[model samples]
Target: MAPVDRVDHNVLERTSLQTRLSEDTNTPEEQLKDIIQDLYQIMVQVSTYDSAGRSSREVLINEIKTLSESLRTLHTSASPPNNLPSVPPELLEYVEHGRNPDIYTREFVELVRRGNQLMRGKLNAFGTFRDILAENMTTAMPELRDDVVQVVEATGGVPPGRRNGEQSQSQPQQNGANSNHASSSAA
Candidate 1:
């Protein structure tokens, strides 16, 4: 489908027949896969709450509850067994807790079903970071954290990590024109 602006990602091009066909005309199985990806992105990335330190801590906890409820729904009807397996280790537990039923809940289920889109975004981030980090990691004082991050990035079922060392995001744009500029120069 040719996206109507708000419906698509920020790609600066027309929808190719291939893209439109793939995105628009997925099989039920494919659509289910896409939803799970979406759930992971939302829960892991966007599902955050801010507190000024005087508000309810329970608010964030409840939000996580809502997310779990949605995921439980998506798990049954849509997600693959591996990620949101039809037979999740927690299914009986969810039922006992009265979170989600066998039937799908649109609010929770839909996002979990959208795995393809979510996974792709994460993968692209990994590749971008990989290029930056691989160029910068050193022999004498290698960052142990970076290696751990790469392991996490490799898991599509979870989330990916940054290849670039921890720096203000603004630093990247400032050095966007240079591929091999070390962090010290940018500082």
Candidate 2:
């Protein structure tokens, strides 16, 4: 068979972009802004791919999952300093309720954008795994695959990793219902 040109144009572009971000960027903040934008796009693409029923884009899905996990880890590793700006309730309300706040900061926008990307990544990993499983199982048992897909969609996808029902039994329950009358009365 003659050699086929199976070139992925996006891969080349991504490599070039990474090189630029690392070497040509003027400051770390600029690099981070670019990364945040790319991550935002990735989360969007992952949603689009899943919605469009593109199960074959496993590599991209996995990359997004990994990037998301990494971002989460990095995000959680260090607590924000006490002096760092806190997200105001009004801004949060504006973002959550779709109200246009009169003023918003770039920092707030970036924080919210990163948070959204992380959430999508964390959630989509489970669905992507389910999709891969459903696709692989469909060839042999198409009907079962349909049922699997239906259940996954109906139940909003399965949680990842070893889900042990018995694990719940190991945890001892804390009974705080009958607290001291003083404590209860104080409330």
Candidate 3:
């Protein structure tokens, strides 16, 4: 039995092709034709060797098949419409790396928007609470109404009795705190 010689055909072909292709001044189509011819010649040369050349034959066949499929695909894809506009690198970079807007549900976005609007129209607790306190003080001590109004005005608060273009109202007939206190005392 003869010893099967194991050879690395890729190393040999790569060295030869690298030298020849580098010096060739042919057009791309001519270069591709030359490659196919060269591969065919190599396939024929490998057949003359013994069974030791089986791997090289398979490698060369697979390479030819791959190159043929690639050439076909390239021919089909090469003629894409020229009207397609090219994306600028800056815009692409911004899209890739910038802080992007979050994707939220339309309902959630609308809810937030409405909440913002309602918040914008909310009553100022400082003025509202101050007005309520001043009104309560005036009711409990009717003689202090003018002084309360003066204090409210000095502090930039709207007196409860004089809000919304209404005139300063007279003190309430029944004070809320006094009525509650009297009811509790009786109980």
- When 1 and 2 are scored with TM-score, the better candidate is 2
lDDT of 2 by residue, 19-135 (tens): 443444244455456457557546555544555555426545645654554454445543468647867776887788876665466666888999999999977776666644644
RMSD of each: 29.5, 26.6, 21.3
71-183: candidate 1 lDDT, tens digit per residue? 44445545364655366445666677887755434544676767767998888777556645543442222455456345545643121122234444335333432423543
Better of 1 and 3 by lDDT: 3
| Alpha-carbon lDDT, every model | 0.45, 0.51, 0.58
Please, what is the TM-score per model? 0.19, 0.24, 0.26
Q: What is the number of residue pairs that collide in model 3? A: 0
Off by over 4 Å in 1: 1-109, 113-116, 137-187
lDDT head-to-head 2 vs 3, winner: 3
- Candidate 1, which ten residues in sequence have the lowest lDDT sum? 4-13
Which residue pairs of candidate 3 clash? none
Top of the candidates by TM-score: 3
List ranges where model 2 is wrong by over 4 Å.
1-104, 139-143, 155-187
Per-residue CA lDDT of model 3 for 1-187, tens digit only, reads 3443554667645554454435355555765675676565555545544567676666666556545544554455444666468664555665678634342245458979999877765645556567667768877887897899799999887654554334435545344445434533553
Q: Supply candidate 2's per-residue lDDT for 114.
A: 100
